[model samples]
Target: MEDKKKFLADLRAIWRGIIGDEGGHCPCCDRWGKIYPRSLNETMARSLVWLAHHSANGDWVDVPKRAPRWLVRSNQLPTLRWWGLVERLDTEDTTKKHSGLWRATKRGLLFAQNRLQVPKKVYTYNAEVERFSDELIAIEDCVGSFDYSAVMESNT
Candidate 1:
């Protein structure tokens, strides 16, 4: 049930910048689902943020048109639904086959709100990969000295 009257008030007091354009998800922030290494970490982090956002705020609400554009391109929506973080419903909106009707289920809300926890691990392997870093690091003269051959030998 969308309380039209309280919507603005509620958001003003507690908007977490989770909702993206179309207003149906929570975007990643605050390092809630952070994993080192940006290329591989973004999606993982976004999924966690989405779940947590929905779990914390389970209301009949939709994001306004002013939402961020990243949501439109995010794959986490389908991924989350597929993984049961949110429930999907068939919509008659023609523009989309489904997604007209969606709601964060109890499980979604709980997990997102962090009433539960998903056990996980992040192993950081510090290996120096040639002097092949960006200009900033080069300028700073930052170099990690490690035996690359030993690491490669272990893998082989």
Candidate 2:
């Protein structure tokens, strides 16, 4: 019985470490720390544009199966969230088989449409700490039509 209780406690602790808090916010954002700034790459910007296009009608969209592996494999989606460009739905994953739903933010749409001017670099923060880390990156060009072919062609 004691071993089972300890195992459950360990699971809870691990959950807290990964999920941070109930709102899905990371430790850095929780403290309102400054976000780190980094150069945006063409591939990521294009991905955001793609997201903006799909979620334009204000509907949450699933990450396409054919999406660039780097988007999820490399954690670009979370990076987008750091820039206030994309957001994930906070629904519980009871089956624990799917990643979750996502959508573009209003800011993201404007940026993708070339109406909003963001820095060539964007601010990002450390997910585990309340301070900005140099590893976070942001956006760049997203001009042209809402097509996934361009993204698919990229070598990333």
Candidate 3:
């Protein structure tokens, strides 16, 4: 129970570090904006969180599966509810199908890169997660494991 609490606390802290606090008006517009306190709405805050989560390797499961996991693990609403924010930012439909797999549209990528405004802490955390993923791959290489390179060769 203690470990779970610590993990949740760490996750929340990491999220807060990535996405600024809710309830603050947009610094750019200085208008009172509707902030997402429960991670359900489309706001700058949720965008950063989505960007960080999606940027991690092997985390690109389809929205249906991935969104529920995020909601369950984070105890917050699914990020898909915030897709409108991305659409608004890009003014385009970011849902695309590539070889039967749904992928981000070009506009989605642009929105993530330019509009998310992920904080330094979030960037650092993503870097660490990526490094961890690389380390796992290296360890697997050392074990003489059969490479499944052909399975998703077209993906690259």
- What TM-scores do the predictions have? 0.36, 0.52, 0.21
- Predicted structure 1: lDDT: 0.37
User: What lDDT does each candidate get?
Assistant: 0.37, 0.60, 0.34
Expressed as tens digits, the lDDT of each residue in 49-155 for candidate 1 is 44345334444324223223565456445544433456656666888755523455665554444343332222221221112112111101111242224222322
Rank order (by TM-score, best first)? 2, 1, 3
Q: Mind giving the per-residue lDDT tens digits that candidate 2 earns over 36-97? A: 44555566687787777777778787775645566656556666665678898875767765
lDDT of 3: 0.34
Model 3 Cα lDDT, one tens digit per residue, 42-87: 3333332353345333334343455545533553222332332222
Worst 10 residues of 2 by lDDT: 147-156
> lDDT (0-100) at residue 58 of candidate 3?
35
Superior candidate under TM-score, 2 versus 3: 2
Deviation in angstroms for 35 in model 1?
24
Task: Give the number of the best model, judged by lDDT.
Answer: 2
For TM-score, the strongest prediction is 2
Ranking by lDDT: 2, 1, 3
Cα RMSD for candidate 2?
12.5
